[model samples]
Target: MSELPLNPRSPLLPDRHPEPDFFVADIFDATPKGDQASMEHPLFTLATKPDMESQEYRHGDIFVNIGPSPIGRATVHDRDILIYCISQMMARINEGRKVSRTMRFNPHDLMVVTNRDVSGRGYLNFKQALKRLQGTQIETNIQMGGKEQWNVFSLIADATIVRETRDGRMQEVEITLSNWLFDAIEAKGRDLLTLHRDYFRLRKPLERRLYEIARKHCGHQKSFRIGLQRLQEKAGSQSSIYEFRRLISKIVSDNASHQHIPEYDFAFDGDFLDIYRREEGGALPSPAKRGLIVSDSARERAKKHAKGWDIYALEAEWRDWVTSKAIEVQNADAHFVTFAKQRGPYKR
Candidate 1:
């Protein structure tokens, strides 16, 4: 058998906490989840350096205005903190524990899970990210958690370094999520998506944004196609069409060679980008065709059966499994409940 060649370039970020035991005891097994609202919009900047620019995006009736603080608009990298907190909250929910908007955790744990640096410099960067998150103001009409009211809020309502090391590095961190974000998390199944753990290891801001778009829109479907101009708008890239095309070509070529972008593969056909799932299963059927509607009662039962597992994630997996196995499920809800019961619980 011919062997696949190894990637020639080194990974952009090293695995800071390679050992399983390195994470905090409570959240070592947490699966990363990204809020659907931010994933769908251009809430973050792609600039590697501090970006002191205000931007506006309008899609139909939804309008978003983002204003940056002096330090910069919150970059995509800064979103990692929010992802970590969201993951923690989801984990708690799966375990049937109550979760509040405000969260407290060891700063090291955040860094470890996000594949970030743990040095003194890393702590300083963490502090800066918190500042950007708290200072960047957003005004939007988008509703989250079913609340539909206009509001201006920062990414985080508040943040504090609760403890510090002798060298002045932050030890403990507490963050109060903005009402907008907190509402999304509280909405549960409708407002969050599971992220591939390697999302933290992506080298470029554009790459990260692209992955978020795919993870949000393509999801578990067989494929999703979008026009290049439309994709540029979704990605919030400031580059012109020509420059964006060049950048995307480079990314497409790189991903083709390295296969580093997780979950999905990318291809460009003329002016449209095609996103295809890497797995071999066929596309999921429509809910109507598959009788895929799960009753509230069934959801409760599945939760009990798959304790500590995100029920929506399991549903996605169940759908993929059904398609892959060519199972003609007559009673989708009952079959999913059985699948959950058989899959059993996972350690939180």
Candidate 2:
């Protein structure tokens, strides 16, 4: 990664590209594939620069879907690409193009962007604009007579912050999909692959190099040799990193961890080591990363408890030790030993 300018609001991720297969021809259609298709009908929105950055909690599921390891893999098969693919959909709308596709209850395109500034005001404004044109031909018209017909609809400012639970309970905690993307983009520039590298600019040297690595991982993160193995386990998730920092930033404010350790590097799902090796041409090993690799014996010991624990579970315990102890928890290894040993021999 390049020398970051230390700007808190810096654009974390470079530009993204569109996905090859945007979506199922009929999102609502139930094929033999068996995935639950929504019958709510397809909806379209236009993505704008503002929507790129925002904090909304409706994103937990979206982030899980588009991140390295989606909660439901089928929903967002290629997350990084999905990032740009969404932008592409937006561009199509901006260009006054027509998007004719079958739909059910799925976002037909990545048109609904979360503005990078002001808590999703762009999307919010867009949505308001939408409700106004309900009766006129302007319903979904983004351009008056330009090209694309994308129309902005409604946006929720900090939309997810005040959501109601299934039990009809409301909470003040709000999160957004843009926040997740911002974290993912900022934490590590490793996955901004060349697939669409031309779209973004990285001013920091460290960040630039990191993107080089991210580009590599996207190709093989799913490969059997290293891809699936990653699912074996990893340090922790990026959100964990943010939670650690947010806890402290609210206290005595120090910018030490300003550059957080992105979830990709330590997290189990991202292929940090693989991309590093490939990026560095197998020389100049990343000692810190290599050190994290467990010996087969240690790994075997950990695996024995795999039923009840994994490396990540230990790290989570380490994190909870204290949002107050981000430094201590830094050594996830200490946690591995402490946690793995406590598991004792499995009940064979």
Candidate 3:
């Protein structure tokens, strides 16, 4: 297998918090969940540097126009803030607790969970990310949480630095999410998909965007295929078809060698791209057994939930239970992990 090409400009960040107990806070336990709308569309820029260009995208009747601020359009990396907020809100909802559009959190906690640097520079970059997120204006007809409306709004309504350290770094920060985004989070399972924690570790901007596409579209299925051209559009890449193909080829080669991409594997063949769920133990069932493909990552997580029990056995039981109950598993991996956790340790 060919080795991953060196990325001099934006190398992948090391896992800063590898130990599970690094975060003792309950909020850190919330699974990362991304809004489906932005994932489905090219709402954020993939540029590593400031991008001042305004872009428009149209798919069928859906239209999205994004304009950058003086600093630049929000990049995919900046989207981390939104993901963190959404995850927190979702956890509150799951607990049957009321949630508000405005959220306040410690900057350090956000940086740690997102696998970002905790240095002074990291905090500064984080504040800049907030600015890009708040300044970038978007006008869209995309319906979020089942509400279809033509509205022009920024990704965030406003962001305030509630408190700052003596050195002037933000300490406590408050962000007011736009109604469009909050509504999507309010819709719960309809507009959000759980993301792999390692998502923050991906180095390249294109790599992150590709993973989102795979997570959103392939989702819980054994595999998904898309034409190369269609994928470029979905990724919101500004590269020419030939250039895009070259970039994708590099990513496929890198993934093939290191298996760095979480959950899904990528393959490029001629004019199409195939995304497969990373499998272990045995072959994935044909047609994914009612679209319930469990990834190896999920299985490992399940082990924590049902200690001393064979995960495969628990999986069989979970599948049987779902079938018996005629339950439609929307997020199969999450549902299965939850089932295992609820099953608890095996009893003699």
For model 2, residues 121-194, the per-residue Cα lDDT tens digits are 53343233323222111123222222333333221112232443474333232222222123222322222222
True-structure RMSD, every candidate: 16.4, 19.9, 15.1
Off by over 4 Å in 3: 1-12, 20-24, 283-348
Ranking by TM-score: 1, 3, 2
- Name the better of 2 and 3 by lDDT: 3
- Estimate, for each residue in 195-303, the C-alpha lDDT of model 3 and write its tens digit: 9988999988899988999999999899999998889988989998877877787677456435577888765754788998887656333224454556667889999
TM-score of each: 0.77, 0.23, 0.77
Q: Which residue window of length 10 is worst by lDDT in model 1?
A: 1-10
* lDDT tens per residue, model 1, 1-112: 2222233454345667777463475676789999888888899999988999999998899999999977999999999999999999989988999999899998888888
- In model 2, what is the error at residue 227, expressed in angstroms? 25
Best by TM-score: 1
Clashing pairs in 1: none
